[model samples]
Target: MPSLPPLLAKPVDLAPLWLVERLARLILSSVLKAHPDLFERLGDYRQTRYRFSPADLPLHFIVVPETRQLTVSRGHPPVADAAMTGPLVLLLGLLEGRCDADALFFSRDLSVTGDMEAMLALRNALDDSAIDLPSTLGTLAGPFSALVAGAARSIRSRALAERHATWN
Candidate 1:
């Protein structure tokens, strides 16, 4: 149920879409590079268009697993085979398999639409990947990888634990 604080969301909302998307692409690319077979686990669902809509952010992240393509936009995105909508933190938690997606869904904390099978496949894939986002992201820091990862991890822990109580 944790969400991005308004203060942090404001700057991101006001920031140029291209810049935000560039950063997003960097993150996705890093993950793809580290886990080349990420989508392969999806099987037939690999070709599905997945829309990850952050309920707390004014953006939609569309990912085509088969092509390993990701697109971030404020405007409308292409039709998706499935879509998941939730707070940014929740979405990130799902991405890292840090949250119990089924529990969240049944609790009405997460909203999933369209191809259920495909979505489930995507979730299974993600869970099996054992993705460590902070570590993967830290690799972007080069010589400062460890320090950056620690900071990111601390921030992530605080952000998820505090929910709307603090700005991370």
Candidate 2:
């Protein structure tokens, strides 16, 4: 059998908006559940929406840490909170907790704007719970290894489905 590529490892290419939205939602859902209090800090943003866009080689995540919550369509500045310029694969690696968040910044593999305060809130909220890939994999896996396999299949499926859909 051919070896599987690293999870989320990728070359530069335009991503399907739906897939990107899905991934962002998944991450936020997990984050919110883990750190409900984190959202509370956003004075009025308890019900705000945010967007992530990858411009250039790095992924730019723009968001307001406060409660006013800025989104792609309704934000004033309409710029990213912090620009994370680096390998997309590495960002995925970091997200999987395969790499330490601090270390990534130190190594310059990732960057952030609201990271200082935003990360503090994130860490405070999610420092305890970790992603239990074993369970996630058991719930959604084929014959291949769980983590990488499941994720790859999920991404591929979403990509194909999105491609087949007619926007009209």
Candidate 3:
């Protein structure tokens, strides 16, 4: 996805839920391919379901690692064994290797609830998984988009930091 300069000074629309899920699935697929024995260590967890929603943005996703499947939740019964909340961009940033997942958890930037075991399992698995993303889109719009996205992220982080400081 290419990001443009914030010329209008309005909220930048997030990529569709499906798009996010697709990217996540692609990253997970790569991990599973590289680590074929990961499931064997995970045991019989194919039935477990986990729901995810961004705390700082509006996006919801349900991921089941055992099956390597993920679905965009449609406001159904929130039936999940565990739930994780955080900024959508930050979560993506972690998967993209732009931020550290452990630091986010330790700093209270992300929150988890529901089945503690399941949450721990996910945290451990993802923290161990090797997921990488290229910030450049690999086309003519790549550099410009990357620059704009980087600038936007800087603004967001500063704003969040200021809010936290004032609240404290």
Candidate of highest lDDT: 1
lDDT of 3: 0.56
Best by TM-score: 1
Per-residue lDDT for 1-168 in model 1, tens only? 677877778999999989998989999999888888988988999889999999888899999988888888896655788999988878888888787888778877789999999999989888877788889878999999999899878767877786432211
Tens digit of per-residue lDDT, candidate 2, span 1-168: 011133343432355545554554555555545545555654444333333333223344444544423332212334443334344444433334444566556755455554355454443333344543333443444455566556654654353243232211
Among all windows of 10 consecutive residues in model 2, the one with the lowest summed lDDT is 159-168
Worst 10 residues of 1 by lDDT: 159-168
lDDT (C-alpha) at residue 82 in model 3: 81
Q: Which has the higher lDDT value, candidate number 1 or candidate number 3?
A: 1
The Cα RMSD in angstroms, rounded to one decimal, for candidate 2 relative to the true structure is: 11.0
| Segments of candidate 1 deviating more than 4 angstroms | 76-78, 163-168
lDDT of 3 at 16: 59
Q: Is candidate 2 or candidate 3 better by lDDT?
A: 3
Evaluated at residue 111, the lDDT of candidate 1 is 96
Q: What lDDT does candidate 3 reach at residue 116?
A: 68
